[model samples]
Target: MPPRSGSRAKSTGTDFRAVEPAPLILLKGSEDYVATRALDRVKAELKSRHPELEYTRLDVSAATPGELSTLASPSLFGEPRLILAEDLAQMNDTFLGEALQFLEEPADADVTLIFRHSGGNRGKKLLDALGAKAVVVDCAPVKSDNDKLDFLRQEFRAAARTIHPDAARALVAAAGSTLSDLGSAAQQLMRDITGDITAEEVDKYFGGRVEASAFKVADAAFEGRTEAATRLYRHAVATGVSPVAITAALARKGRQIAALVDHRGPQNQLASALGLPPWQLRQAAETARRWSPRAAADAVEAVAQADAEVKGLSRAPEYAVEKAIGRVSASING
Candidate 1:
């Protein structure tokens, strides 16, 4: 959830992220629909806490910046209001100036401001200021393959349906990664299956789930017991996880560990800041403990080189990923 800055609207009840500096951020990199859905969930949570909260929704392209700046003003009803700045970056500078000023003080109107920016940091100075006065979050995009799989798992869980991992992957592949496609597929599958969405059902409705060619590459790279990292790199290339994805993941994880070590920040807070789900933190902590800062730095460099090779230097992704992972695991485990 993004940061939101507003006074306690004196609702009967609500959980508006009791964080000190509230900056309502739509997750960076998430599809607009997915981000919006996340915002909706936050609203639901808040509603549960404050039943009398009011809402004002505006289209980004249509609403000028002035309108956004004033979104939090108190109304005659005296109820706390929430403003949805949809597609905020679409507005012109005429509105941006006023918007930034409003963010500076953001009156005590018993309202919360939700600013959603796409990845680019256009007019971000004000956002930076908000970070000090409110919460600042970067909602990054999710990977198509893994992200979709995660989304499916979440959806199925919500619907009280259990889908095999393979089944869930198939749905994502066939349905495409877009929300419209995935959501429609899920709804139809639920209707058809009427209960548990099994692998057999996936085969029936979404077609047979074929082996993902990238698995061999991913599996071999992680096993650490072999020199097959290079071999699997070739297989990953044959399929479509993208060679860069493999290298990037290794580099990203290494960098994350390094950040944790260097900052020595609070464990739970660091995990939240790093965006790891609660479950992954312990394993990551253990990994960090065993890894010297220098080793982690070298591993990050190796991954960077591999990323350049596979993504920019025309090297085979399999070779790049294989080599990068081997070096990383060696350093991490050594």
Candidate 2:
């Protein structure tokens, strides 16, 4: 029989990191890495409790009519079951009808249904139903540096290890913007290091990678260090970082500084308004201090030209990027 209305199986909008095993779990967001991790946790927890758990995977996009019911039905031996239904965002009409029907009278407590919807309006009806009844785990994209730092901290905290905030920032800068890459780097550090992780340790392991990144060049350029920016750009390009990547970094930096040039509101308010972390806003504010409105405009123009040049407008993309770096540095210095 279906569980009572107020059963413990329902969660009140749980985060991906805090997901618990439930009869109906919905990983609803666009971030596959976080969703996969949450699903793995649920699977592990279920396995620990039911050693002989019958695991099944269903592609809801290709599901046939009544497939979900067939899978959720009791087996002869009555072993617990875990049904991981993926691609809900691309579910067909047949699956959608069955899913809605299944929701009206869900399977027994021994059956667990996990739905992975990677964002869309394709299955809004089913999503609405799951949102009200299932343990909804948000698997939203972690795009900002602040969110990435939180993820890194959680990784260490999960293992009962302490990661210095500076170390976490360093890892984020070194690891690029990919969550999976950052997670793997954190896991490797936790496995290899003995004590609390430090910035020094992070640098020792990833300093070269950081040096080769376009961010280093962009940072130096925005700081008005012309020589350092030029040197870093050359080194980054030599290390296989493309001219396009360098121009992209410069464009991003310019946008950040330009956004804060004339802002007079409270720092936190501005950060929230701009959808940027406080630390990032603080850094941009520091750079903006040296930049007048005209200078910021000039930097933007310079970055735009470089972006065009790198994207096939000019043959000497390397020289174009170097020229853009020099112009940005000069504008900041002025």
Candidate closest to the true structure, highest lDDT: 2
Candidate 2 global TM-score: 0.65
Question: How well is each residue in 99-183 modelled by candidate 2, as lDDT tens digits?
Answer: 8878877458788999998877898888878888888887888887667878888788888999875567667767745888888
Q: Give lDDT per model, in order.
A: 0.58, 0.81
Q: Stretches of candidate 1 above 4 Å error?
A: 1-23, 46-53, 59-66, 106-109, 130-139, 154-161, 187-196, 208-334
Candidate 2 pairs with clashing backbones: none
The candidate maximizing TM-score is 2
TM-score of 1: 0.49
Q: Which ten residues in a row have the lowest lDDT in candidate 2?
A: 3-12
Off by over 4 Å in 2: 1-13, 211-226, 230-334
Query: If candidate 1 were superposed on the true structure by all CA atoms, what would the RMSD be?
Result: 15.5
